[model samples]
Target: MAYSSGGRLPFESASKLGHLNVIESEWVQSLLKDFETNDVDNADNYENDIWESFDPSSVQSLNHIWAADGSYVSVEENHKELAFVKTALMTVEQGKIAAIDKEYPHPLKLQEIMKDSALFHATVFPLRNLKSDKGNIYDTVRHVIYDSMRTDENGQYFETLKWLAYKKWDGQKNNSLSFECPHCSKVIETGIPYDQDTGICPHCHKEVLLTDMIGFHLDMNEENASDSVASHYMLIMEMLMLFTVIRLQWANKDTTLISDTLFIKDGPMTLNGQYSKLVPNIREFLNFAKNKERPIHIIGSEKSGSFFEYLSLSSRFVKPDPGIIKYAVLNHDYIRRVIQRAPDRGNPYGLRTNWGEKVFVYLDENTHMVLNMTTGGYDRSDAYPKSSDIIGLQRILATLPALVSRKYEGALYPIELVNGIASMSNYPSAKILQDFVRDAVH
Candidate 1:
């Protein structure tokens, strides 16, 4: 018996071929346009001038701060109303004023009415000045309110607002120290110094490293130790700048309120490897602060490497200057060996080696021979290389004094020899060296 075969098409196959649950591209595009237009209109309607809209008398002096995960929300239905109130508070604190129509020209004017209305309750709270104000009732309440209002999509922004609040109230204590164990829920009470290696959590008995909490670990002897130290030192400088701006703003309450500060990183800003995610937010926050003119400064540190090479190659954007120079001082014998092995070409003080690469060598009384690898094998008797061609080396020499004054324990050689070798590979005459020393010493 031959029966007519009738089978339903599989949902996956139908969906894949755009036969089931398919969205038209034009429809999707129209929907996106609607969102885009709405966003633009909202942004245009947003009040840029918050100060004019805020009432000084209505200002709620937030004294106690709690850093809560900005992703939790209460399940209770009544708490939903409280969540709305909390959201309104957060929006105001975060510089997001409500869009007003003809009925409400100023949002603060509406806020005042809202504060007086039965629906809204106004409370005057005392501020806590101590860092040890954790586990307080007010903190717990604040956390509950924050968690109720926070959502997963806005979690990062919520955390950022929490960080900013912590800075305003506690002076950035949350970032500087850890009060709770990240791995364990145990509270750490020990007032450990920031540079300390570990803080013992009394409850957990675990050695909680401070660096682990602050997202940086210190190892002075690690390979590539200088890079780590340099990066951390640069961050410290930026943090100092941030603190300076905050202090300035706090001192002058009546002046124009500044929100964003700027930091100019010296090289291409990278947050790769262990610090990949943190660098972007740090840069963004810095840029935001800078745009607001919030007493911020930008700094960039440069050394000889790919970073400097890239900068030199793109010198059109940068002013014409000698590139940076980096040298490692070797023992006197080592220097002599290098110079002796360097095969001479017909050019004076210049050599062309077996590999057909030319090098210029100059021996200084400082027991160091300066080699010019960038200038090629050119004799000093020939046309001297442009001073601007070696700006990198010049910058290194210029910064040496400040480095030395900082008590940096590193190898050093005569700056004059380094400079002369950098500019002209033919070592300066003994008479010239003596005269240079006389001028430098005086």
Candidate 2:
């Protein structure tokens, strides 16, 4: 590799794989044919997911909002990987806004806590080739999960773990949790009470933590798992933090607060891969709360994803009138075939994982909301359009107009603030956190 006058004398890396084999490969040609086979089946299927002549639902607006967002960064050096995750749950009160100084543009502004927000949870993982306090990263990861779900930053009862246990057993303490033992592979039903975090499996006589139901231990071993597992934990913690706030409001101080609060999650209300086992319990709790009449109001907005991209392309026809808030109910089939480009095998999309149904809300000209909303229960219906099944649909939709953000194409104000707090910028954040980790290891 030599630099000439133009600084362009670098040779390409040698490859014995061969570029010509890409076309000659039989499997590559078969994959292309498979994609072409389903091209027509995934088109013109928007009738059921669309809503034309619709007005936003009329319900008492909930002014208080709890928005959650998180960031995960990892550093790998010397054959060791360390990951840091920070999640922020910001509480924004709509009633706090007041108009002032129209000329100076201070008409309405949220208080700036971007530099140092107190309402955040931080966790570290020794993902690979590293030792933790427990002598093994596997147990250390377990301990970290246990610690966060058990308490807030102030070391009080956060109750997210209890909430997980509470949801697992019919949203009540008088029930029992069922799980298959990893040691013996036998189904065990334990009535260990909801408050307790860890218990022994009756069948195998082995220790089982409440967090074991989350399935993180499946991939994690003493040998060392990938640092990518930290991102999955970040997602779980984001939801856990949101639910911790909601559960506290529902059970502890003011139960009425849950009704007046709008919960906003940055991404979809989904638990992917191994962590998806909690979906049933999540729906159970939502239904339980609805039956108790404290009914939760939550929605997840996707700023950029395949669904957002799909809506951007099809926005013209489905949502032309800016004045009207047109929406589409995304069925599992459309998601699987058209959006996801997978085989639609007649099962609900994210059935075992997602707690909310994906809906595209066209809010005026510039903003569109890709909301993952729950209608007080799990989505079991194979029905094409599920707009009618959504409880408090109008209230959730009506509340969004105030929360929209003009900074990005599909943005929300609350989510933006939380993202800023939770975000880890590469310039200083990564370098600083990595340095801290290196120094902390004596």
Candidate 3:
């Protein structure tokens, strides 16, 4: 009865409400009274030295503000599921808009400037519903992913997106991607096949696809594997697309554009799980670019999380003069002891995956930023990341004023724009997608 044209039944309604009666009973409540969890409230304890203040230095405009975001929706029907993943890389020239528009610009002037602003692309891969798809689920997934990366948006994004992974944005070429073989556990390095191409594992002779390098296939199984693979696919797509944008900014040999542009990824600059293998490649590319004297500026802004919540709470203390900037580098010890309440022993935070350290910036009492930022590639050291390594924190912070958006609290314009491009409404979007897949199969 709860179904709304999405399918046979809403999954939530499948669970009967009869269990609530037992949970509401006094005897059941008494049995559950001893459980406890971490305190969600913030502590007032002092860490006075970590906080730093600076005079907001005036900086030149960023020539292009580029942001990347992605979304994926899974459609399931009659014991089968498929995922539709969509990602967008949107770019707008903040400097040009201000130079051309008047003090109170007309609506059409703004519209005309933004008419050609975004590059959007979408692709599909097999999930639970792979039986009817062209080939083996894993092989089909690899083919689709490879083609997705090769997307060409007219002439604007002519290069294959996979070129970011398969080759390099600024270095020597490697046509093959490598990973530990799932069957034999030996490292298998080879090129992805064209059409139904498959790599033969040298150690065990197990056939592998190029997409296996990322490890989404590890989470996949014959039973109800749609969501896990879909989520992983969405995240990897977002990271790859962001780097693809960075590659585009490189423009083959015109590297100065990299310095003049600002890249904003929707979430933290970290890739987790088996997907984390991409982190080293990212750090390597950033370092390679830096060694060549081309450092790109990128920031990841968080809107809803423990970190963002802490920023909202801590911003109460940051009331500075008109020109002063207040910020705190959330070092590992502070994060371990305070934010996460984890035992100080063990590995450094994000030792395997994070390319940037967390830094909380306060623009004003009303504008607080919880940022994951880094430059000169990802930190590779075992020791705590130093403040100096965050190469352009001050410069990037100075440019924030021109990019802030009033639509959301502490939101930046480019991220807000990409969110709009990537966000999909569930009611209409899911239902429509489900209908389309259903029609296509018939």
Candidate 4:
């Protein structure tokens, strides 16, 4: 029988088959074993000694809010070799979609079917190389993405990642975010680490492959390439979306119409892979936005995770203040107790990619409560730093609860709007992109 662990069950249970239930239990056990082997018990480390608590009394009024999200799918044809990847980027402002970007990268085999359609003009992606390699599509897609990152909406190229990396590396006292050698697993730094494009790891004295350090594995076969491509597209969308926000704020600083606007993203503020090394640059970008006429309240809210699961359990015990919103930073002890399992006896919280402090916001009694938050703050070197702006974080906490869905426990209204517009399906987004190209060309 499905019973409520916390006053009421968080979700309704679906009818379960006995065999499926057995399979699920076995899969969970396997996952627990894998977690123990990885030593995830000691994975979370908080830099601060004391987690600051805040009392949120009131929320600031905001005029505009912007949220962005992306979705993608891979469609393999009858032959299984030829595939098409359809990706969509949607941005919403004030509960309406402000922009949309859609792209379909298909194999040359699709050209015959899509005769002269405008959709296939530059959409015919090459899968083979001059030597007729089978998986050259990866390089072609990478090149297109790289070019897009450098180019603006007007098709003009500018220095972005490389320049930002060089600037940040030049200013940093030590390269804390340096790539580890694949051969030695030791961090290495070059004389001009950012300018070289690529380098050899000093520890191993071997060439460093960007693909290894970056989470996205570029050298994988076509079947696995879809994941890498999707991740790349999402990351690019995030970067561009942020760039647009900053640009708009910069241009409209003098006018009150754009000032005091809040930008919300669907996930954590931290970027992963080689892109993660640019955290310092992102901090600088935030600083640039803040220096304008009115402060830009940019923050991210996560809807799901093990962290949120634990937060839900921990919430049942706390009695919150109604007049004042309460919050605390997540320390090592709290995180370990809540998230760690058996066999993890060590005390290293191994969260390095995230630079912000993880905080818990207790918003009122039971309309819905507890936001797992990370705040952007002043930290030049360490990827995850202890020092965060409590006031700024409090501002975010205050503003967010007002935006939460009244009927849903963990969803924000802005994110829900963008998800409805950007989410993909096999029937609509993926199938439509594929069918249209084939139908138009034929």
- RMSD vs true structure, all candidates: 32.6, 9.9, 11.4, 13.1
> In model 2, what lDDT does residue 419 have?
85
lDDT of 2 at 330: 80
Candidate 3: lDDT of 398?
70
User: Cα deviation of 2 in candidate 1 (Å)?
Assistant: 82
**How do the residues 1-442 of candidate 2 rate in per-residue lDDT, one tens digit apiece?**
2212222211111133335557556776554444334332243634334554456554566777778899898989998988888887777565442121212324234433222232667778788888755568777776677676665444322455565656632534643356655455576675355677677888778877676666676667775756656888888888887886665666544557678878899988888776777677777778778888777888998878899887775665553565467777887766777789887576677777888888888877666778888865655555643787665577777777777775777778778767877874431221111222233212
Write the number of the candidate with greater lDDT, choosing between 1 and 2: 2
* Residue pairs in clash, model 2: 57-394
Residue lDDT tens for model 1, 232-330: 323332332233333444344433332222122222223333333233334334444434444232222233443233223222222112222223222
Error at 171, model 1, angstroms: 11
Candidate 1 structure lDDT: 0.28
Model 2, TM vs. native: 0.77
Once fitted onto the true fold, the runs of candidate 2 whose alpha carbons sit more than 4 angstroms away are 1-49, 57-59, 96-108, 112-118, 154-158, 168-176, 180-193, 203-206, 252-255, 424-442
Error of 1 at 161 (Å): 16
Against the hidden reference, what TM-scores do the models get?
0.24, 0.77, 0.76, 0.57
Q: Name the TM-score of candidate 4.
A: 0.57
* Clash statistics: count for each candidate: 17, 1, 0, 8
The global C-alpha lDDT for each of the candidates, from Candidate 1 onward, is 0.28, 0.67, 0.64, 0.45
> Best to worst by TM-score, what's the order?
2, 3, 4, 1
Q: Judged by TM-score, which candidate is best?
A: 2
**Model 3 C-alpha lDDT per residue in residues 168-274, reported as the tens digit of each score:** 45445565466777566687765443322347788898877556667766665433354667777777777765675666556534557678778888778777777
Name the regions of candidate 3 deviating beyond 4 angstroms: 1-43, 46-49, 96-110, 151-177, 182-186, 189-198, 377-383, 424-442
